[model samples]
Target: MPAIVHFEVRIDPERRDEAAKYLAETLAATRAWPGNQGIEALVDDADPCHILVVETWATTQDHDDYAAWRTTPEGKSSLGEILAAPPSKQVYSETLPLGL
Candidate 1:
């Protein structure tokens, strides 16, 4: 089954717009990455400095591979110095719906 990954990042208030633009420019590559089903970038309404990236991957290993690539120099170069704190990530699986 596909996995859902939540990535949360806190950007400096002054750099929030830059951060959003960066995501917009870079996420197409992410969406094109292997095993990536899709991704959605969201910002907190009450806290614009907070950003959330929801990603769907074909499997956990695929997400792990993507993460490994992100640590490379090329990947690091693509992501400018926009984060106020290290990004946080969590992986989740869908729960079966309860029958009424």
Candidate 2:
């Protein structure tokens, strides 16, 4: 089954643009990942400082691989500064019936 991952990020209001820039660059890389299906980022219209990143993958294993890769020295070095705080993440498996 496909996997859906969501991450909620709370950033400093002053750094909202910086955070968006960082995500734009990072998500570009994710979009090219082997198992990545889709990626989206949304900013809360009412609360500009809050951001949500949603990702879809071919399978759970794909997300696991991505997580491992993210811990690598190269990845950490690139992603270290953008985050204002640790992201809250969740995983979901999609279920759908045919012929909606």
Candidate 3:
């Protein structure tokens, strides 16, 4: 089953456009292992400083691999300026009770 990965980042309001542009380019250029599906980014309407990135992958392994890459010095160097603070994140597996 695919996994849903949620990413939340808080960026300086004044830097909103810059943050979005950075994310857009980064994700576009990112390459992942097999089983990677797609990614979507959302900006909070009520809070311009808050941004969310939702990603779907064919399995947890793909997400793990991508995450490991993000922690590397090269990765940090690329994304360092776009962040106002550390990002908040979570992962989930979809479930339907009663086979629904």
| Cα-based lDDT for every prediction | 0.83, 0.80, 0.76
Estimate the TM-score for candidate 1: 0.86
Cα deviation at 91, candidate 3, in Å, is 0.7
Q: lDDT tens digits, residues 2-100, model 3?
A: 998898888876677788678876776443446668888898899888888888888888788778876787654354476789888898877778874
Runs in model 2 lying further than 4 Å from the true structure: 77-80, 94-100
Best by TM-score: 1
Q: Sort by lDDT, best first: what order?
A: 1, 2, 3
Q: Over the stretch 1-88, how does candidate 1's per-residue lDDT look in tens digits?
A: 8989998989877777688678877787788889999999888999888889999999988888988888887665344478888889
* Clash pairs (backbone) in predicted model 1: none
Better of 1 and 3 by TM-score: 1
Q: What is the per-residue lDDT of model 2 for residues 1-100, given as tens digits with 9 covering 90 to 100?
A: 8999997888766666687677777788788888999999888889877888899999999988987887887655343365667789899986767887
* Ranking 1 against 2 by TM-score, winner: 1
Which is better, 1 or 3, measured by lDDT? 1
Candidate of highest lDDT? 1
Cα deviation at 82, candidate 2, in Å, is 3.8
Deviation from native of the Cα of residue 100 in model 2, angstroms:
8.2
